[model samples]
Target: MSDPHIISAAVQEQRAAIVSQRDFENLYKQYAPFLLRVCQALCHDENLAADMMQEVFCSIWDRRTTISVKGSWENYLYRCAKYQYYNHQRSLSRFRTVQDSVFAASDESDDSTQEHIEYRELTHNVNQLVEQLPDQCRKVYQMSRGEGLNTAEISKELSLSEKTVKNHLTKALGFLRRNIEALFAFIFLIS
Candidate 1:
């Protein structure tokens, strides 16, 4: 004879395996915000983060019938968010490489050469200005802009409050802005 407990366990397993629309809604409600925060922390752009988070949830819904969760949903969703953010970044890098090649091939005239030289000079000047910033300010600026880290990550990594990180970044940018204005004016007069 069939064991009653075994049959009941099998029934519960079958029910738990299929996520209903209501179950999906509940998961979205509970984790969407958290997922969005994860995306933002990775990329620091609100709209892009939102889009990536939405894509993760949409993909989940599309594959809901075949998906099996063996662990906690939070970890699963967090991995999904990270995967989406990295995927988007990879795509952007590829697109930029292609775009740069196209632009490079299309512009080879004297004006293009002059523009390239100007761009190089401007970049060099910016680097010099960045290097001139105070030590902590430079580190904060580089982490926030060069490494694309958000203020919170910079705060944690540097063991400073978020407000202090912001202050450093602000001072660094302000100093750069003031100096770059002078550089631009000098360039404008020359051009």
Candidate 2:
């Protein structure tokens, strides 16, 4: 394979080169293998890698007469594949947050005994973390989270100012967040 820097420099010296059909085919033949490997490594999925590689070549072919590379031809193609992969990922735009996953799994995977046990264990661990909070913070958290009460409702029920309830909830949540991350990792591993 020719060095991309040398090809890039030569093309630059000759001014912008036109990518005719023959040039496009040669470029595809030359770079497809390497580009596919790069995409495969980045995506970690063979089908996705192939799709990305095909998109890169197809796009180049579509814009054969107009597309211009400012730097190395290899680098330009690589960036095209990378951009296509990212665009595909962004297009998914699905919600996969941990809270959604954990809670959703409990409702959806009831057939699995193992999952139920894991959920029970996770619940127990979370309760333990909640118990470790200060008395007022723990009470505020229980009212807000366990009782599904809003800030105003909790304030009225506890006979405390809204701001004070908010502060307690914040402190309790922060403490739980710092502690829950490790437990979540363990659940993720076993599940």
On lDDT, the candidate that comes out on top is 1
How close is every model to the real structure, measured as TM-score?
A: 0.49, 0.43
Candidate 1: lDDT over CA atoms?
0.78
Q: Judged by TM-score, which candidate is best?
A: 1
Model 2 clash pairs?
none
Model 2, range 75-106, lDDT digits (tens) per residue? 88778888987865653332235557777877
lDDT of 1 by residue, 30-105 (tens): 8888998998999999867766776787788888788766457788888998898787777566556655754675
Q: Among all windows of ten consecutive residues in candidate 1, which has the lowest summed lDDT?
A: 182-191
Question: For residue 75, what is the lDDT in candidate 2?
Answer: 85
- Listed per candidate, the RMSD to the true structure in angstroms reads 14.2, 18.1
Off by over 4 Å in 2: 1-10, 13-18, 94-191
Q: Weakest 10 consecutive residues, lDDT, candidate 2?
A: 90-99
